[model samples]
Target: MSRDQLVTLAQALRELGGAVPEPVPSGAREDSSFSGGRARKISVSMPEDLSAAVQQRVGRGEFSKYVTEAVAQRLESDLLAELVGLLDEEHGEVPEDLVAEAEGAWPDVE
Candidate 1:
């Protein structure tokens, strides 16, 4: 990133009450490997019956990719539900401070 962009981002983060000067990771391949890049290997696990079923339906060659994607989608959905519950607990239907800021704030909004 450019120097000006970095400065602006750090200032925005500070406005949100977080510490500045976090360590930036370097010397790693961080760019997207999308255009004609080599594929990488990944591993996953499943129950014996489920694994057998996937192998039967898609075969070992393509089974890993499909199962990995399914598992990732499931994990994302589970995490979202959990985070929403946590926010509800911390802030109620809406944060009281936010509600008290402006009158008639949420009229007919919800």
Candidate 2:
């Protein structure tokens, strides 16, 4: 499988409480305030089966952390998709050679 597919599978496994490697931070953004601030309670309704599955996987009293991680992952995916769509609209599809060049240069530091 491709690296992207593997990554998606790993994230799914994490959300389901399966053993997986800890994710490395992307380094694109850092917001420490969220971690230090108070957390407000929010209610959400889901299908009974999904709720049951989540409860079974994460157990009681841990739903908050599970939901927080799930929401953060989903929001990251949504933002990335939106950014890609906007870039495609503004610049058309990126060229293959340019993509290769960027990939080649990515590993080296000045």
Candidate 3:
């Protein structure tokens, strides 16, 4: 995504009471090897209260990592939704009975 779009998303998350990390410097490179990809640094705007809350929970050093994970999850969810839409368009919606059966078969985790 473009930097401006990321900034806008961060701001929206902040407005919704979500924590967003301060931007990493242009010179810094995030080691995203753990996730099998390279990471890019970009600027983001977030509220001080949310920032403080995140720091309290994960500490200042992990702020960026925390936000990265949250954004990743959101993106994955968006992709899944898009996939579902495509599937529904190609082959009508899944039967409610099948959905109910799938839900019942899904493992419940504590």
Candidate 4:
């Protein structure tokens, strides 16, 4: 990986309070014991402000490791959120009367 990409990855890991990773063996393929599923792509928008932040870490000759780490983190975060919503009592749907009572009396979604 490029030097710029390596720095980028380190920042991403640090931001997430994770350890930086070691390089894979020279001939080993990227392991995916936890890969989500068959891959597909979709686009999402990011605020312009984030670009400068990303670029600052991925500047010329900088490590670009942050790209992979960031993507993995984002995917993991989204998956965990989905799982939590499904499994957590507070996050998913509620009975109609309970919802109304909470909404009217407590003014809170939960």
* Most accurate candidate by lDDT: 3
Please write out the lDDT profile of model 3 over residues 21-52, one tens digit for every residue: 64333322243212433566689889999988
Ranking of all predicted structures according to TM-score, beginning with the best and ending with the worst: 3, 2, 1, 4
Cα lDDT tens digits for candidate 1, 1-110: 33334445555545555455542223212232111223355565668998888889987677655654565355445444555555566556666777776546757665
Off by over 4 Å in 4: 1-49, 61-64, 89-110
Given candidate 4, what's the lDDT at residue 73? 59
Error of 2 at 36 (Å): 2.5
Clashing pairs in 1: none
After superposition, the stretches of candidate 1 with alpha carbons farther than 4 Å from their true spots are 1-45, 93-110
lDDT (C-alpha, whole model) for all candidates: 0.50, 0.60, 0.61, 0.48
Candidate 2 structure quality by residue, lDDT tens digits, 28-93: 122321142446566898999998999999898877777766766665565455556655766698
lDDT by residue (1-47, candidate 4, tens digit) is 33334445555554555454542223211333222233333454677
lDDT of 3: 0.61
Better of 3 and 4 by lDDT: 3
RMSD of each: 9.8, 13.9, 10.4, 14.4
Could you tell me how far off, in angstroms, the CA of residue 68 lies in candidate 4 after the best superposition? 2.5
User: Number of backbone collisions per candidate, in order?
Assistant: 0, 0, 0, 15
